[model samples]
Target: MSAATSPPVSPSAVTSAGRLAWLDALRGIGALAVVAEHMLPWFVPSLRPYWFSLGVYGILVFFLVSGYIIPASLERHGDVRAFWISRFFRLYPLYLVVIAVVLALSWWVPVREAVVRDGSAVAAHATMLLDVVGIGGVADTMWTLSYEMVFYLVVTALYLTRGHERSGTWAIVFAVAAVLVGLVASGAVFGGGWPAYVSCAVFVLGLTGVLVGRLRTFSACALGVMAVACLLLSSRVPWLGTAVLAVMFAGTAIYRWERGTGPLWPVAVTGALVVIAPVWAIESGWWWVQADVWLTTILLAAATFAGGMALRGRRLPRILVWFGLISYSLYLVHHPLLRYFVRVSGDLRGEPLAYQLVMTAAALVVIIAVSAVTYRFVEKPMQDLGRRISRRCRGGPQGGGEVRVPGESTGDDRVLRHEERQVPHRVSDDVDQGESVG
Candidate 1:
């Protein structure tokens, strides 16, 4: 999954699609990693390795991608209203579809026990803060959306304050907080259903103010504060939530560095801190969070992002970009479809290795096919609608025009012209901007 607007392209850029093909490539790889992480356990248990977590690696890549692009998206538009509109349409249409599918299949698959135990599925899911507020997602992958939402709220606030460029400083701050919180805090201070309700109310009120432009700054700040508080006080693991934010900001820091506006040291420092954050954390009992495995996963994810950045000027393989195009659908739809497959075919862990491998391949084919369809009919249309609505809100014609802000790069301006020619009325092409989870 990814959560960033597509980077601007220059008219002379060699990429075929007028979009960042490397980012799409990264998203595609991350999505496949997550899919394999989930599918292997049930389909080919022996192939599932425990040396490092595929799921964690995939999601970290997603967070980095989101961090790198989301700020750029908001800044390029220079309008919180348009930014949120693009974000909502990009994320929610498929998200709601997944939720509805899960509920409709509940009689066959049954909702996760954690969701029932938390007893605030509606409220938590509505806010996409389910994990931090102690609720389980209808789909296991949905836990990641909580952190994504938090990042979005905080990023929006920072954009409103014109402090969004300080990505490196924010990354370091969150990294330090993660270590300190790990040392002192053990579990959620605000547990149970009430926090969900309160947080949901705050989310609603804050988002309403942001969209409506009434006391917008205060509302954005309040939402930011609330988001941070929830991450520290109400998450399943405070240190992890804090560290995830650090990772995301570190990504933004890298983006700034690339654009010649930020230092690179904070990215290094934040990465170091995040790597060690869970080493001594009381809440971190999972094997993957142990020093060795965690370090490997973090480094690999970082390297992957760096590799993508290095290749940004080149044309990536079209298959990878296509995968990235449907990556969001792949991320949201794969797990439930896998569950339904299990319900129909029964667990194949006991099957022969060849048979299991064949089945897994078949399942992957189905998932990719379904994801492509959903992206075509569901995600793309909603995104185009969002762009049109955003243009109307900005008092622009719902057709073709370039939006030039004072500080925007000349390269971006050229890219905007190219985009207008190729994809008229498009604000962004990267719609699958969220983390992939297992």
Candidate 2:
């Protein structure tokens, strides 16, 4: 195959046409779960107590999918500059659109004027590091982007340090660290003090190290330390943040094992740690009330991820795949849509269950329809534009027949095997192609 159209060498990597259907299916399911999690409880108040935080479950699945794929993308290309470029184009365009929508809505809805004026909103938009910078997400659902950005930085550091091979070990280490950090630094250690400043500074230093490609080992260590600190000290809920990251790395470990780059025992151990971390680290006020549901979320997420792996080669419904294709748009757009729905519908909390269900169905339809349009008009065009620019910079053909990047679009990747030429993970588009970075 030409460079413009080559197969992803490993089963863990995803591409546009060569994507594993099961993963698309998984992402689609997760997207729906997120929507249900946010909107369902609003309409059916009775289900609030019973639901195990569908949003958490959905976003966790997304994070795992990301971890499984992103490092591989960086390694396959071995070009940090290209990786960053790809990420910027794939993520920022849609993000800006969402921010624009939110701003437009602010005319009527009560937005925090202080946040917009105090430079916090600008910082959040520019870096997607709002959570680490001591500001909450501009959008309620956008907080995960902060963690996702940190993950990308951490992976870049690992790739630079040549420590990418020990993904499984790191997963286990992070899981253990989560527990330890929870015990000693349960609350925010750097809410707004020198500790916070130091944390952000070290993070910047680590990113600089990755970019410079000098003292890579030291850079990786610094980034690793910063990642742990951010998770433990900078996050609003340190334990939960740590647990989520542990789960993501566990997914990475499993990907490594599946690709035959690591032994199975490490993945097995990491999986166990992932399962246990939430139980140990989650600071549920009513553990008795929350534990079972939390455990259920963990188990369900694991099962969903495992199911995706098992059915990697199976054919799935096109509609389901379509949902996955639009998953990123759905994730970013649904929040605003939900808010709009509530605004127009007035208080549905006291409405009849049947009426509320109908409204929810209507809302889902609108969300899906808008998401589809965005995926077509916004996502695909920008992805193409990014590829065109990249290909031009690389002095390659710009024609759209088969222009490709490692984890972006590729030729039909029918062969799934252990190749030394592992495919790169495209952090921009998420999982493989057509996946969200969630």
Candidate 3:
């Protein structure tokens, strides 16, 4: 039942030219796959494939997409404050709305047992670090946000340290850790409600420092360390957590390789290690983690991503691009809506096959419609506000120019030009977008 999704790219990074439309296509594919994964069981049990998990496939695609674009978005702006601002606005509005909807409907659909059991849902949701801190998300899909937040913190710290470009190395390191840790470790080492509280405090203070520009490096480092520590010692599954980071970093490594800033070996090595990370995992009992299924899912996700990259220069279907525009809202809202639908309608599993298909189609239409509305109303306006605020901050006296990392040089101009050429094809709204599980 464990599944996750990625967040959308910052508004500032998006452009009217629809650059990165391939990514939007990928996000569209991932989003629908995840929704179908969640929906098939309820609507058409017979159609739910057991060979390879659609949810995992979607999540891996999202993680790869996130890995590839998040660092690029941050680097493209070269302003930590702007990056954080954009991310916050892009992700939080819809996220909070989902949480609120879930809570409001709790009378009809009880809160997830895990959330009620943990008693730290407030702290966990507030920090969006639910899984790593041993708390369930208010909505089932929220678990992925924990890892997304971790990646952001780690990337921010690396940016400050001028080590952000060493993506390939980090990918290798984490991939190795996944295999090593899966052999022995499973579940949180720091068990309790306390990690959530402490981490939340640190998260707030660290982010405050980062925004205020006082002790920014120290604060970012602290947040990064806390993020890694939580992933290693406090996650529900240490190896899987590590593996997720490896996948994301692998995405970053791929981005580096494409930009000519790094080599390709790490990408291959990371992919191999991740493919095998869960094969021998002592803690993994899920059917999807079985060697054959896991490998197929991994390879399929890799292929899907490669296909998107290969098609990056072409004009993606407008329907897919539109789906990408509302991906985040769809990802966040669909789960709760599904739960509510099930609660109200009761089990439809015993319905006739045709009836089930009809109901499923109806549900999808509703979900997509609602998602689009939220995207237009909530996500879009908030993102626009974030972009304006970022621009204003950058225009202020204290607003600075692009940050120059220690190892970068004039050669970056060529890379920037290369990126600019590619930017027009990218999906402006959905850049660095994450997917969610069913």
Candidate 4:
């Protein structure tokens, strides 16, 4: 709400285009976390437990972003079918591909004992319902799907109801979460509902933010400071505090960032904190490290959120924006690829350290390559099909839909004008997106 001025990093001159670019760039960072966590787990065990935790943030970011965008999407569409179909197209095809790949890999590695010991867990993951209980099977990375799906169902249902009342949408979302709590508490699904519930809470907070509009006198610097504090505070007991503060602080960041309401210091300082936080964790001892990681992650998430807010009407490289576009497929597919490497290599010690490193890079490269192909051949086609079908069903916007990117809301089912459109045939043979590791 700071008079809608642009952020420091320049990019496209379109309204909200920066949001897409910056958010995707942020997601690219999250995907790297997933890729690195798996590739190096053999090298670092302590960080292993936190892999799913960090990877899960990518999903939470996406889901909450979706909630913020849903209302805007509803406003733009022909009707709800377009909305639902669009979502189905966006999610299902890529998911189906991942599931198939997982099955194929699991068969190859049946190493039968692990599967026998954890077949049920594997089954839950394959079905994407593993979140019903707190147990994550072999591929722990997919745990966020439960919340993503739940958030999608709630938001889609709201859209389908043809009720755009912000309060009403949130009421329904919370009610669904409450029912989920009841179900989980009774052990009906025997799946813990914490992640899903926490995500749901975040989604609701996002929805509230959209409806409430920008905060008054909300200096971006203040937002950044508050975000860092809340982030560190939440780390003390992540399941509760971290999740809650993530919603609150990150929520503020998104609002101000989207409105372009804050100053450069917020983004600059936030980015600096992100860079230093990991070192803080390492140098300050285990306790600080734990809290600092969460703090760093959220602050970076916020910073990129701001990046997305600014990318519009500014000038930045096309490569950065492109990465944001393909981020989804990269995220969904990376873990299975990582596990495949683990299963195939048998022992990391035998190969020269250089060779092991090569093996890791090879695995990531293959996943990215395949994911890029999937994006062009599978995902894009399904999206086009959805658009054509939506047009047939409701005949408005001619398949124009919207979705939420990490930091900001892009409109709905069909992508909005400001949001980057998915070209059915475009492939950046090089994927030259800028580095996200900072």
lDDT of 2 by residue, 72-187 (tens): 65655455545655676778788888888888988766454324454445645466765655565546677788788777777766665567778878777877776666566646
Candidate 1's error at 299, in angstroms?
0.8
> Candidate 3 — which residues are off by over 4 angstroms?
1-19, 117-119, 279-284, 400-402, 406-426, 429-438
- Which residue pairs in candidate 2 collide? 72-425, 73-424, 73-425
TM-score of 1: 0.90
Shift in Å, residue 208, candidate 4: 28
Q: Across residues 1-438, which tens digit of lDDT does each residue of candidate 4 receive?
A: 121331222122123434334445555655665666566655334335541245435544553344334433443343444554555566667777776666676667542232224444444443343444343434445555544443333334343343323332233333333333322232232223343344334434433332232331122223223322322222122122223222322333333344464333333433333333233234445442355465655555555555555553455566654555566677677766665667766766555667766776777778789767877888778877866665565544423223322223222221333233421122111111111111
Task: Give the residue spans of candidate 1 off by over 4 A.
Answer: 1-19, 117-119, 280-284, 396-406, 409-415, 419-428, 431-438
Q: Tens-digit lDDT track for model 1 on 199-304?
A: 9999999998888887788999999998998999999888899999999999889877876777999999999999878845524478888778888999999999
Q: Which stretches of candidate 4 lie over 4 Å from their true place?
A: 1-19, 43-60, 111-127, 133-139, 157-290, 349-353, 396-438
Displacement of the residue 142 alpha carbon in candidate 2, Å: 0.5
The estimated TM-scores of all candidates read: 0.90, 0.81, 0.90, 0.58
Q: lDDT per prediction?
A: 0.79, 0.66, 0.79, 0.43
Better of 2 and 3 by lDDT: 3
Q: The CA-based lDDT of model 1 is what?
A: 0.79
Task: Give the better candidate number (2 or 4) by lDDT.
Answer: 2
Candidate 2 Cα outliers beyond 4 Å, as residue runs: 1-8, 12-19, 48-51, 112-117, 193-227, 275-289, 392-435
Instruction: Provide the global lDDT of candidate 3 against the true structure.
Output: 0.79
lDDT for residue 366 in candidate 2, whole number 0-100: 97
Error of 1 at 209 (Å): 0.8
